[model samples]
Target: MTFARHCVFDGSSVGSEEWCASLDEKDKGDWSANEAADYAKYCVF
Candidate 1:
């Protein structure tokens, strides 16, 4: 949260319809394998 905000990292992918629909609070700070993949496509791609 803090790191991304300071760096201006957009989380649109993770929070988008496809990614966020599959997530819950359990997958917040500590990401599961699937979440990591989604984040990669959304935030890294």
Candidate 2:
């Protein structure tokens, strides 16, 4: 969170959607993958 704010201060382009997708791609900092997996499992019921 601190690093993200610094990156924005340093003239990096930042958007909520971009941040969300980047976090999703990394799959380390966020729980996107886990949530998706859970949803998929529930859909099978």
Best by lDDT: 1
If scored against the real structure, what TM-score would every candidate get?
Answer: 0.34, 0.28
What lDDT tens digits, residue by residue, belong to model 1 across residues 1-45? 986674446444454654464564345778778777766676453
For model 2, how does the per-residue alpha-carbon lDDT over 1-45 read when each residue is reduced to its tens digit? 887677655442333345445545655545567555643454334
Clashing pairs in 1: none
The 10 consecutive residues of candidate 1 with the worst lDDT sum are 6-15
Off by over 4 Å in 1: 1-29
For model 2, what is the error of residue 14's alpha carbon versus the real structure, in angstroms, after optimal superposition? 6.9
Q: In candidate 2, which residue ranges exceed 4 Å CA deviation?
A: 1-15, 29-45
